[model samples]
Target: MVPVAPTVLFLINEHIATEALLGEAFTDHGFDVETFEVVPAERAEDPAGHVTFPDPAGYDVIAPLGATWPVYEPALRDTWVGDEMQLMRDAAAGGTALLGVCFGGQLLAQTFGGSVARSPRPEIGWCEVTSDRSDIVPGGPWFQWHFDRWSLPPGATELARTADSSQAFVLGRALALQFHPEVDTELLKVWLAADSNGEALQAGITHDELLTRTEELAVDTAARVRRLVAGFLTYLAGQPRPS
Candidate 1:
């Protein structure tokens, strides 16, 4: 039988550049991808509040890209959180892969009964991640930009960590990453230009610092992210179809 094209849903809560880069990456991996810009029309309003989509059962994978706070704040935290959680659980239950990046990772943790709250110390810029599961996230430095942290969900395995945060987690075929291994220079520039790095960025971190780290290891880091995503897809394909 000819293999069916696996449909992948790319959630662009905000950060259009990131949405494009991630979609391109997955497309290169041989999956059909679609993107949605879910920013609410009104400020301080829920973006998803005004949008609608069918069940996640239609997709072979659900990937929520990292975004600026205005995108995830009042909107995602309120109106969209539950629905996204349901979508995540449904995808996992249906044996479809689920990969969450940054705030996307927080969403995944919460879906699995974990808590998402401000970290003791907000991690900004590039930081070294020690992989607890080397098979998933190979140890090295991964880019981080967030003021929050998450508790690993029940039955979830932590893939990586830093001095201040649990950087990555995995549950079933689901994978959650607090850092942006998928971050490319263009997106970085746009994100910096918008001054959306949150409290961490405001704490005196410099763009030069981030550029230096990412530039020094861009090739290697991309390779690690590839390994991580490939591992998740392998797990997803191995799962039995739901009865």
Candidate 2:
């Protein structure tokens, strides 16, 4: 019998920040991908519109992408954040693979009893990362743009880190990354044109420089992201399901 293509459910918080490179990587590995926007475009300006998450167990893999909204806001937790966290917890417990990026990583950490808070120093643009398991999580000047960091969930193994924060961790079938291996120059442009431009400038990074750097690193970055996704799939396949 022919096997069905594995499906990846992407929880995209903003229209501008869809799967990008990582989605391509998944497709290359024979997975079908679909996106569910938590914050719909019609309701982009309204906080009330951001209060829903789909059932994560339906998909073979769950990928929660970056978000402009802070994951630790009390108001959010009282509404959608709590529900989303619960969904992630359930998904992990059910043996669904999770690939969390930036804000999504914070959500995964929080779901596993870890915590997210404002970092003393926000990491923006390209920064160097140190990785103990370079085969799975490579050391790099990975793309990072966030004002917060996670403390990591209990029993999660730290795979990589930078001076300012923990960069990557693994717990069960989940792999959480503080840096954005998924972003491409096009996605970065959308972010720069939106609210993140000021933060980029504040970090002493300019749009032209960022775009130029992205152009220069495109080939290598794509290769790296592909490797990470391939490694994640391998890891997920080897994990024993909970009885």
Return the top candidate by lDDT: 2
Question: Which lDDT value does model 1 have at 114?
Answer: 89
- Where is model 1 poorest over a 10-residue stretch in terms of lDDT? 39-48
- Computed on alpha carbons, the lDDT of every model, listed in order, comes to 0.73, 0.86
Q: Compose the digit string of candidate 2's lDDT tens values, residues 37-139.
A: 8877776665443355677767889998988778888877767778788888888888888989999999899889899999998888888999998878888
Give one digit per residue, the lDDT tens place, for model 1 in 156-186: 8887889888988888777888988777777
lDDT of 1: 0.73
- Deviation (Å) of 234 in candidate 2: 0.6
Consecutive 10-residue window with the lowest summed lDDT within model 2: 43-52
